[model samples]
Target: MAQDKEFEIVREFEVDATPEEVWTAITEGTGGYLWPMQPPEPRVGGAAAFGSTVTAWDPPHHLTIRSEDVGFPTQSANQLEHTVEPRDGGRAWVRYVHSGIFTDDWDNQYDGASRHTDFYLHTLREYLVHFAPRPVAFATVDGPAASAVPEGLEPAARALGLTAETAVGERVTVRGPHGRPVEAVLDHRDAYFIGLRTDDALVRFFGRGHWGAPLGISVHDFAPDADAKENGAAWQEWLDGAYA
Candidate 1:
């Protein structure tokens, strides 16, 4: 029998950017893209997004952010600790540990968050490489998983009415659910992650398995004129049906 999964998660990423950049990406975010909309106010006990509190803050090194489990998307309060260690060649090793209550949705939430680890770290790299100061936004949605990588990728890409091929730096055009002509170039793709940069947005996808298998998708749209809330709502509804 397989070992049981746990509610706490620990993930690490080797980022090519300097420790400073990685630290900023984890804490403040870049190019108008913030994962949780707002970050902890940088000081211990400072205000943060998601009604979380900053338990510790060590610039360019270590930080701890904790928040109540209520009202969050997962509806679970958790604490995330980030440690950034400098590496040779201006690179850094980024580590993240998230611990919280199980709250019954442990399996679904854990699998989903596990898959998201790849997307999150990958986006951190993209943010460092393409650190645009322009405004950007994020959209996170969850659902049943597929079989494997590219399992549901094709379908989602198909809905976009375009081929779903993993080719970094490749350009592609596809319409969103609203029939908006969205064009983007592939930034990175591996067995676990797909990074796409749209004319005014940065989109990413990860994992491909079942409802509890683990898969994550995020969009970072950079266009001061674009409405992220509307975009997120549209994608949420479209995905609910697409994967249903």
Candidate 2:
């Protein structure tokens, strides 16, 4: 039998929110930033997200959750930990750690996870700074298998009127599913990810084709009447057209 190798990804960053707020954001999820998460119980042995068990818990300070089976043959166990420290001016410093044991295909798995950590943390900062405490309806969809090529993100960028030269803070307008023009600010972009923030929502595109997965899209709509299922279907249809 092959030996299982352990991997860890650690990220440290500063955010504009206080320690309590940052704790809430990481533990409970910020709607537009992360998938809605139920806060774990305040003590060890409580359940956490992703079928994990809480191994450590300290309110507004530290938390650690562990899972025995992560639903992947390549992985045996997974652990996620977060530490928050208060800064001088109501801001907080956060340290996040994701560790796991990989039974196989370690390189690809590690690379993908590390890159995604960057994107997710960036969205967390955005949420803390601009949209904290707002409830949002979330939707996600994936493109067809045909969109799993190296050039897959090209069509999505074009559909959003973006290009290789699109930089952060640039303004652009795109037609929503209902053909309504929506103005958005490009918030983040890189080889495998793109993010746009509008007045009422945060939109993200995942160029997973670069890592052998189909493209993906997610929207966090803060409108009071937002519908996740309906919007997910509409965005899926739009993605179909983009790659058609």
Candidate 3:
């Protein structure tokens, strides 16, 4: 007989923002960073997105939410908890935990989710410190199927002038969709992920093919006139051109 296995990911970090600011960033769906969340009802036992329910809610301090038992044969019980505290020098310390159970393909699911948590939290800090108060237009696009191989991200990286030798904090200017110039700095880099930040936007690239999915890009455009749908389509065109 088969069995279910449990996994939990915990992360702690400091961000250069007050607890209230961090709280707004984490709980709002402003799309300034990471995935956008639907506004959850602000109380314990209230409804949340993704078939989850709010188990605990405390403003600027703590929160716990869990997924309902959806009866997916291979998985159940996804929970997330977050705690925030004020720190010296106008900063905040954050602790995050995500726990769940899986009945199959445990290793791949665990690795992907864990690494994604790190990247998402890093982006959260970036948003709180630099891009708060601006409404963001977010766009996410996946590369063509041809880009779904071991080196799935290399083409996009090369198009953006990134390489294996690229180091964090390195600055580069690349032409984005519609020949728009993106003057930015490399904020994060690793074997399977890349992040670029401009004065008005955060651009993230995921080499998901390393784990059996297509390479992808997400842009958080903070300009006052940004359009999410147009941005997504333009990036999709750019990606198609790159693979062509």
Candidate 4:
């Protein structure tokens, strides 16, 4: 006889907070609301289910869950395990691993698991940033000259204060200290925006545009590291490189 193999999905995040703080956010606070599942009580044998069942639980550290078999329009029995580890400098690394034997189509199920883990990590960031917040926004280029912005770059530029003008099909560039300028184009389908961090001069590009009226990014009090300026510069470098 041969042992059956299980499917698994894993996600990781670097949180700028203490392990205890992150744990509270996950177990006691906003973690449940962000993910597409009910709030987990998260106790030993506490029966946690996020489209599944609770198999194992350990506070401020690990959670193991299992899904049951159901037909199409539902899911099969899949096991999910989450782990949190404290890192240096008040940061934490959280990983979500999902495993199970899939009788169903593997690709579709794996894709779904990837999406779920992405959402989970995103929600975790939201919670941590809320506790240690900043000012951010998503801005769309709303004008006739939107054609001047680059394709797949408007949302990101808008987050960084780029706006549309009357010049249709015109190309505009915002130069950095080095290399070619970051180009922006205007198009009809380019209607979405990107996530911008205004506290510092940096914009982050996300795959999907935010869905809602523009909301003000919240600012919270967290002690800046001794190398705060260096960190900001490094982030800016990464953004420039990414957009370049």
Q: Which of the numbered candidates is closest to the native, going by highest lDDT?
A: 2
Error of 2 at 44 (Å): 0.9
Q: What is candidate 3's lDDT per residue for 1-244, written digit by digit as tens?
A: 5478999999999999998988788778448877688866799998887778988899989988889584667577788898999999988999999998977678877898899899888888888888996889999999988887778878888888667787899888877887777899899988788899998899999988877888899999999999999989999998888888
Q: Estimate each model's TM-score.
A: 0.69, 0.95, 0.94, 0.48
How accurate locally, in lDDT, is each candidate?
0.67, 0.86, 0.86, 0.47
Which stretches of candidate 2 lie above 4 Å from their native place?
1-3
Please state the error at residue 231 of candidate 3 in Å. Answer: 0.7
What residue runs in model 1 are displaced by over 4 Å at the alpha carbon? 1-6, 30-36, 71-77, 137-154, 162-169, 176-183, 187-194, 205-209, 212-218, 224-244
* Candidate maximizing TM-score: 2
Q: Once all C-alphas are superposed, what RMSD does model 3 give against the true structure? A: 1.7
Question: By descending TM-score, how would the candidates be arranged?
Answer: 2, 3, 1, 4
Candidate 3 vs candidate 4: which has greater TM-score? 3
| lDDT (Cα, 0-100) at 5 in candidate 4 | 40
Cα error of candidate 1 at position 136, Å: 2.1
User: Which lDDT tens digits does candidate 4 get at residues 134-218?
Assistant: 3222121122222223353453354344565524334445432234344543211123323222222222233331221221111
Candidate 2, residue 179: the lDDT equals 62
